[model samples]
Target: MLLETTPDTSAFMIAGYTVAFVVMGLYVASLFIRNRNLDRDAEMLKTLFEAESSPSSKKEAGKSAKKPAPKKKSVSKKK
Candidate 1:
């Protein structure tokens, strides 16, 4: 009868787990940073859009309320 012994893989298992945890942590941190940047961009775009549209619309309304200029009459003299 021959007896067989299994090889110990605890170091490899620990290394694998550590690599997985570090990769997962880095991925999560990247996601958080991207989300924060997107939120900031959204807020900036909203403010810029509001500022541009509101003032332009008000100016258009003011222009529309005014009357157009009248045309001048031309006179011709024949001798």
Candidate 2:
């Protein structure tokens, strides 16, 4: 009669699970950071749009418009 022995793979299985969980955790953290950045950008854009579309800003821009500069006299070169 012959007896069969089973091989142990518990350590490899544990290592694989640990790596998978760590990768998933990092992915979740990155997504949260991206969402926060998007929120900040959206707020900044809203503020910019509000500034550009306000009546007072338009009036101020029109009032402070720069005048055209005078033309300079050109000197002719002899050929």
Estimate, for each residue in 1-79, the C-alpha lDDT of model 1 and write its tens digit.
2576777899999999999999999999999777766766665566555555556757666444332321222221211
Per-residue CA lDDT of model 2 for 1-79, tens digit only, reads 2576666888999999999999999999999777766766665565555554555656666433422221222221211
The positional error of residue 73 in candidate 2, measured at the CA in angstroms, is 53
Clashing pairs in 1: none
Best by TM-score: 1
Model 2 residue 34 lDDT score: 78
What are the models' TM-scores?
0.59, 0.58
Q: After superposition, how far is residue 16 of candidate 1 from its true place, in Å?
A: 0.4
Runs of candidate 2 with Cα error greater than 4 angstroms are: 1-5, 56-79
